[model samples]
Target: MRSTSQRSVVIIGGGISGLASAALLARDGYDVDLVEARDGFGGRAGRWERDGFRFDTGPSWYLMPEVFDHFFHLLGTSAAEQLDLERLIPGYRIFFEGHADPLDISASATENMERFEAVEAGAGHRLERYLDSAQRTYDIAVERFLYTSFDSARPFLSAEVVRRGPRLMQLLLEPLESFVARRFHDPRLRQILGYPAVFLGSSPGRTPSLYHLMSSLDLTGGVQYPHGGFAALIDAMVDLARAAGARLHAGTAATRIVTAPGGPGRARATARGVQVRDPAGEERTLDADVVVATADLHHVETTMLPRPLQTYPESWWRRRTSSPGGVLVMLGIRGELPQLPHHTLLFTRDWSANFGAIADGRVPSPASTYVCKPSATDSSVAPPGHENLFLLVPAPADPALGHGGEDGAGSSAVERIADEAIEQLGRWAGVGDLSDRVVVRRTVGPADFRDDLGAWRGGILGPAHTLRQSAFFRAGNASRRVDSLYYAGSSTIPGIGLPMCLISAEVLLKRLRGDHSPSRLPTPMSPSPSHRPPPEGTIRS
Candidate 1:
């Protein structure tokens, strides 16, 4: 057994959560090494470049800027000093199928209210009231729940939860769609309020109303973008981990988790290290006192560890609702798209039908697509006369629904879906012959997620944030079946999103430091209501 001073840590995966965990552990005097299966460190936030165009492969939206700031600040600097962030004006545009004009959601409350008034009478004031209630929900959730590791029910018994008990019950018990419908008369308004639920990988009707806090983050908190691309943020995280004395190894896949010998007399099995394979197909064993898995929880438990050491079995995972996967198309276009904003959403006429198709393990044709034209905000991503575009369509994560057979035929199916998505996007944006302008194109699908990132069921977002699968009900940061083993990332506590990943690292660090009560962790600053929009013209449908 190694002494506490000589203890070393091994982290699996080089995503934001893994990097953050390595940095914090290294700073705490533990010798740390992080292994990533992919050639890059960003995981889903990976990047690609070709023909002078850079595309952020995943996570284009930058919400909850303060969470990033707090994480960087813990490493002895500020996010502002490490990265250049620009706030997007009129945050995004939502285009309905038959509506002549798209609804623009502005950062400023006054502007958004005016737009709402144009649709339904007295809707502007109603939005304000709803947002106010949402703000309260946001505050309570952030301060009391988000940063904590709910190892027990003690935290929920706090005075704050008691005082806000009624409100919490209302939010948790109601469905997001029902909540929005009760508050807004117009379908557009309801869609605007309910659309954010997609971020949690569930339809509004299935998602809990407690997630309405996302609306506050989107409307009042404002959207932000890293200067170059999401890749820059990944670079910052890598630099921070390196500076903190953590060694990072890309292109190395962890094949097995080595554990201490267990028998009838042994109390529990302990994580000893990891067996890994390099890019050259060379396998090696790296010993460590502790192992932290920041990869997919299901993959780690089922593949890396022995079956008997698994805390969650295949049956357990099968019952949990996996989040939906996405068909992502990255295109480097030869010309500009004037109709597309920095972020644009084309919603179908029947949102229910779209949701139903996805639930039934099928891709929705004429899908509700999200288009990100980064060149509209950051010119550095593309060549002088070109535009960088990313299109994402929410689809089922079932391997059976994928185009080809699970093993090798899925790529072809992915391409067909991408082509169909491009056609749909062109029709919505009124840009005929979109394929002619595409000089470069790449497509990623469910099988890509499963093969590349080891995502369970090719789910891009991990487990869905259903009432039964959130907080304490979700996977724990520390493994119960093995000693000296911990977990982080979207699959664990604090749930999905980049902000939650950062918070998950914080939770893990607190547990390691013997601070079992994570409610004591410092709260990140929330956005104020004073974020006014810069002067920019709105793009209508």
Candidate 2:
């Protein structure tokens, strides 16, 4: 048995949240170690460079700059020190068919509303009131709600949540369509207000209004990007973690978890260590004082731990409203897209029918698609006279829709769905010659997300943020059944998005350190020489 004096921690998964946790822990002076299944860090924020064209294939948008700033500031540094951040002028653009001009959403809400009023009449005032309510929701959510682990709504079961909660409720119970209808008479204006929620991968009618929090992040905090692309932010955090004394192991996958006794019950089982498979198919074991899983909770529950270590039954997960998965096309256009901005959102006329298909377990037809042209702000991303484009469409984790079906990515049905998406995007972008101008093209769908991101059924943001599943009602940050086992990332509390991921990491760190304790953790400079994965058999390759 390992001695208690050998205090060390092992983190499974090296995504933004995992890396953040490692940075905080190591900086606090604890003996920390991180393991990743991939060859590099950043996870979903990982990037790929080919032929001098850099693409941040995942998480193309950066809404809340303050989150990154706070992360670095906590570490006695600033994100600006390691990354060059560019603030986008027109935050994003919205393209609708037959409209003489596209609307540009910028940091100046008054100006944006004035432009909307000019097109739709009286839209400016209505937008003012609408944003006022959204601002309240954002204030309360960030200040009071987002920081804690919400395993239950008991904490919010008060008059405050009852009153302000309805503000959240107005966003939650009412479909965004109804919310917009109440505010605007113009179809175009309504479409603009309702369109952003498409990122949730559900129609405004099905998706709750509360998700309007997205707008607050953009309009209030503003959108910013790292000069090198989103990947630079991840690399910055990784550097901070390493500097703080955290040990990272890349291309290492955790296969099994060993737990303490409870006679096959979750409450008594504490995570002790893990079995890892390396690139060469060799397996090794390592023990630790604590285990934090930034991996998908469903994956960890079903695949890594014994059945007894699971917090909730598989039936619960199967019945939950899993969020939408998607297909992302990364392209290096040979020529510049003069009309496109840093970010552009293209809306399909029928979003309700589109999301309805997904909710009913069908691939969306004529779905809304988002296009991002990062090179508009960061010149270094593309070679001279070129543009980097990323197009994303919300689909489903359903196996039926893999890569147009013939190539056999996963499901033939999913493939067909992807093919349809490719076709539709070509039409919407008005790029009739997309197949010709494309210098480089790569596609990623639900299947790739499932395999690479460890997403459960490729649900990118875990369970949907429905009224029943949101807030403290979402999964707890700390596993109730497992001892010394904690969770961080989009799957756990604070829900999805880069900002929330960082907050979740901070919450986990707080829980690990103590109950609101302010003292720094003592650093163990030299780990015991004998403490190593057994030298006997080969580790998983």
Candidate 3:
């Protein structure tokens, strides 16, 4: 591998952020190596295959096309060339608990507006206004907030932001639930707009209205999927990282963060490298000039680093709010499910009780759930005659709730949730004989996230996006205690979701290069090392 720069970097975790960071640094001439505990890469964007059936076991939604595009551009590639992308029309279907027909939300702004009009008298026009405000804030955020190190208050206190300070502050202070409820009287309409806060790992009641920026994604930007599942995207990222001269070690668990010698305290001490336990259980060390940890921040802080060297200690985390964990059920069915779309949401009418139960650490009976039927768009996910279904039920961040298993092989509590979800789908979504059609089944609970991913509180996403945990208030990218030790992932700044993870890596690049500008990168470093794939449609957050 080329090592002309002499400066070497060791990245922990092989997730999106970790891999992206590795690819960017390696392309910049740093000798880089990344290690992951899991046997494969992609972290939460994992994949599973069986009997010619494949599943994107982790993230299903490909939101924020610009972030993905820019990230690939930085790596001397373009998303259009690196992978085949499909923009999902009528992006998703929403099925109410008692409604006979489902509401389809599409990429076309006019089509979605008409659907909104049909739901409520003036909601269509109101939605237009809502999205306008959301887009404005989103643009501002993309420019001034998402790509920064937060090294100073200048980004937030800029003349542009200060001019809009009162309005932005009002949005920040109000809860999302209140914001949506006031504008849209129809519960379905409100739920449609507010549900995104759930994926960000918090209920609308707790998340700030500023997150209305999320509306601009599906409502305006639409949803996207990469053919061959997310695994194909992961494969491309791995390929790029490898081409850029980065070494990847799977099944290698990093046990500790080694630091410079002769340091009496963590302050001002440089990171030496990472101490890891390999597949054979043999311990070894990988030396580095700098270390970037893109794993779950809680795991790296509480488990990988020694007491004094940890920037966020156990006590610090105790006081912070983490996002909700989830119950994930994957099923392979025996026949076509034309009644279902690629993306669907089953929202209960009484979401106040539904989401409240989750926030209070209880399972919402008839809980609001997200269902992904990727087979509608990708033929690679299942056998020719069969369909694939993945279910997500928002649950409390408690691992003791139980683990998942094939069929009902795991915890009774966890299985019960999965069982109820199946029945709910059959009842609300009219998917008759749903249970009988399941030829393959697997359920993942909070414990699996903890055991498999080292997720804090077994959270599916990292920290919750509460007003207190938003933006600069969130955990930083660099270690405040240890020099040369940095972090990039869902748990760190820029917050949750796949797009945020990509931006987090760019933020890390800025931090390392001592370029703290929050604006978009002026230009790609070099010509792309890829052939462009023809577009199926324009693409996401």
Candidate 4:
């Protein structure tokens, strides 16, 4: 192990990945400093409050409780002790366009199977068998893939990987839609099994079957919600990082990554420090032995580093597929929404057409949308008589789509889309006169993501998880052109989602420590029902 004497590191972006990295490295004896451009440290998972209504700006669904538990355990504490989580039974309600009533997806595996049996004969048993296979795939991937940094192929050529070679190959070759289609005849069941891919910013037909582990994570593993909101988890992480001896700077934006002077003989540049602008617009340079960038991968490579020292070029990013951006509407309503559940999905009947429009760089006329009413579960988000509603509609990330007003009338463009989205939500999900009931309203589109978080192409989830952009094929965590520069975030290996961010941080930590042993996969554990919500006024945005 390297000596802890006077070693210092600088981390850019205070997202989940950056916070996790800073905390872990500090605990391991490195002096760490994290800088965030935003007023707060959550990045995409930031929070906002207006007129007594609190909203979690991003990532409402909390999946993979085990990942959170394991991360906290690594820090010598437990997630349960830091924050309270409630398993969302009947996790979400799904509404098909032509169907009369919605289908409720239960948290219990047995209940889910029974619901499947109700839909079609023997499908329940088939689902049971499918989840069994999915569980095994999840186990293998968590053990051999998700936690390791893919610097080379030698680690993957181990005896364990060779033994599971055939199964792995099969998973890699098949598409998620094809895999689900082969098993279930019911379109709704197939849709349920395949829709999880959308969360990864992929079409079911384009995503690899290796991602079917999500089904196991949803159906068997379960979906959870933090008591205060998703932002509560961010608070927990920030508290943990600060407690571990890392200094966090909010409202400080990194301008560029500085490097040692280069000459003809120096083939590789060495990272030295970072130049940053503080909240008051004052600029300064902070020196460090190593730098970790958890910001947008494209922004870091193209804008932060010098042209000659940059590893990935603009042309390379242009060739890669980026995930779709979204149009979000946050409405604080006057009264309760009796028809809507805590989580609801309104899927268009023409799923193919919807995906085609997004892929072809146009917003679909009638879009499938997701709605979250957190007040249904926890009333603290809003006043006693009101409800907090958040609606998300997926759209193409093309800048020309007028999301951020490239045409000079950006606010009007956003208003037009918001009008359509509200009408659709009212018509499909039974929210009557949604526009008139709205007391507080805020809209966020592709331009918001680009301006606020510096997301590449205004994409929310980073690069699309195409086969070529996943696992070992994704961007390496360590920089090839700069020796002491590294990356950790949704754009790097192991892919997106909150769990992946945590895993990305761990992977970077192991690489920095030169410890390549496989991470012990934590067995999936059910959240205890005994936990209670945090006391009022405990967690702040």
Estimate the TM-score of every prediction: 0.92, 0.88, 0.95, 0.93
In the range 87-138, model 2's lDDT, one tens digit per residue, is: 8888888777556467788888787778878987788887777787777777
On TM-score, the stronger of 1 and 2 is 1
TM-score comparison, 2 vs 3, better candidate: 3
Candidate 1 TM-score over all chains jointly: 0.92
Q: Would you list the clashing residue pairs of candidate 3?
A: 63-541, 64-540, 64-541, 323-464
Worst 10 residues of 2 by lDDT: 518-527
Candidate 2, superposed: residue stretches over 4 Å from native: 1-6, 98-100, 151-172, 200-202, 262-266, 403-430, 516-541
lDDT on C-alpha atoms for all candidate structures: 0.84, 0.73, 0.88, 0.83
Model 2's alpha-carbon lDDT is: 0.73
- The residue-by-residue lDDT of candidate 3 on 429-534, one tens digit each, is 7777999999999999999999999999998998999988998889999998788899999999999988999899888877877777788665575412231211
Which 10 successive residues of model 3 have the least lDDT summed? 532-541
Selected candidate, larger lDDT, 1 vs 2: 1
Once superposed on the true structure, which residue ranges of model 3 sit more than 4 Å away at CA? 1-5, 261-268, 526-541
Per-residue alpha-carbon lDDT of model 1 for 1-541, expressed as tens digits? 3333346889999998999898777766567889999988999889988889899988999998878888887777898999998888768988898887888887887788788888999998999998998888888888778888886667688887898898888778789999999888998889999987888878898888998988888888679889889999999999989987778999999999999865576536989899999989999988888899999999999998877788877988988998988888888888878888899998888999999998888888878989999999999999998899998988899655454222233466676777788888887778898888888887778877888889999988999888777766788888777888899999999989899999898888777766666463443322112212112332111
Residue 474, candidate 3: how far off, in angstroms? 0.6
Better of 2 and 4 by TM-score: 4
Give the top-scoring candidate (TM-score): 3
> Model 2 Cα displacement at 73 (Å)?
1.1
Q: Which stretches of candidate 4 lie over 4 Å from their true place?
A: 1-4, 261-267, 402-410, 520-541
Instruction: State the displacement of the C-alpha of residue 401, model 4, in Å, after optimal TM-score superposition.
Output: 3.9
